[model samples]
Target: MDLLFKVYPNLNVEEVATETYLQERSILSARNDDVATLNELAINQFPGELHEYLAADKAIEDDQPIKNRGNIGCPIMLLRNLQPRDGLCNGTRLMVIQFATRVIEAKILNGSHVGNYVFIPRITLQPSVSETPFQMARRQFPVRLAFAMTINKSQGQSVKYVGIDLRNHVFSHGQLYVALSRCTSSNRISVLLGNEDDDKTTNVVYPEVLL
Candidate 1:
């Protein structure tokens, strides 16, 4: 929590909507659940009327409903390649501008389409699961809150202020390096470790793979 505040202070300030302001900062974490929790906390602190959108989910075999959600004024990442030519590809970051029953209005934060406003409509997405017997499809605006994102998702994005949640030690090769390098300056990067007594965290390395 303290890490989040250190990275993104003054959420209510008018600069929150500026493209440069949103583009220059982000929080990185190793786990999806941790990222979601941090994103939720940051959204709740943002100055905006809360708007919620429920996804229409269905099991491909049984038409069963699965619940997913989104909100307005929240920073989000495109989950699918909506349009590559326009730069609305997967991992593109954007800020929600408006919400309707079936579409979301957002401004592109980075990439060639930066500052461009676009409308995102609901789309059907099916996950490939070899272990599960039944396949499920979710029809929703293809985005997820991104105030805090997984270290994997943070790849290819450069930010000025980066906060890394390292309470759960990194378990993949180069995960720590990726998180640390996202920031342009070492001094601008802040990491949260398990305890004050230790400033160390695991960085998984395969010795044979290196040699």
Candidate 2:
């Protein structure tokens, strides 16, 4: 993922001036790295969480659960089902697995979805293609997306405000640049652990990449 981010530096919004922060609050309030907070939010709202314990009759009430779209809260589980579709010579089903830490794993589940799954190979570092334990599960059901994290699809996209995990190892020069520069001004950006010293090696880099 680091290599991919480096190669496509322009894909992520690096200029804060372009973002729109609809919610005006401390950026930490967003808690981009708090896995516990995200789990709480998901369990509180998702259909399967604690519903059975709350008023059995009310819980059984026939009502469509609200669908989550747009910027999903962190620590989300994305499940994608891979099915073949006629379009590509190599029938590959599309499956994208993205981690909260911004690592992504994409694979071709079946030949039909090959076209849809091509984006991953084109943009990111390719993971080894093979049948594994995950394939066994995929064979039984349609697997779309899964997993949870503090940051969701919002990481590289333009946003009004952003919360970043500044743990030294996670804060690479490119990451710091991307996270801090997402907001328009310094005031618009907030770091949870701002006191830590920046790693000198990661902090200093070739200036040309910044361009």
Top model number, TM-score: 1
Candidate 2 lDDT over 1-211, as tens digits, reads: 2221221222233231111112111122223345444334423432221211111111223422222221221122223322223322221222333322223344333223322323221111112574543311111111112112323323433434344444433433344555555555665554544345553323435578769
Residue-wise C-alpha lDDT for candidate 1, range 89-175, written one tens digit per residue: 999999888888888889999888898999888899877665677667777778888889999988988999999999888889989
Q: What TM value does model 2 have?
A: 0.33
Q: What TM-score, computed on C-alpha atoms, does each candidate reach?
A: 0.90, 0.33
C-alpha displacement of 131 in model 1, angstroms?
4.0
Report how far residue 113 has shifted in candidate 2, in Å: 23
For candidate 1, the lDDT comes to 0.83
In model 1, how large is the Cα lDDT of residue 161?
A: 93
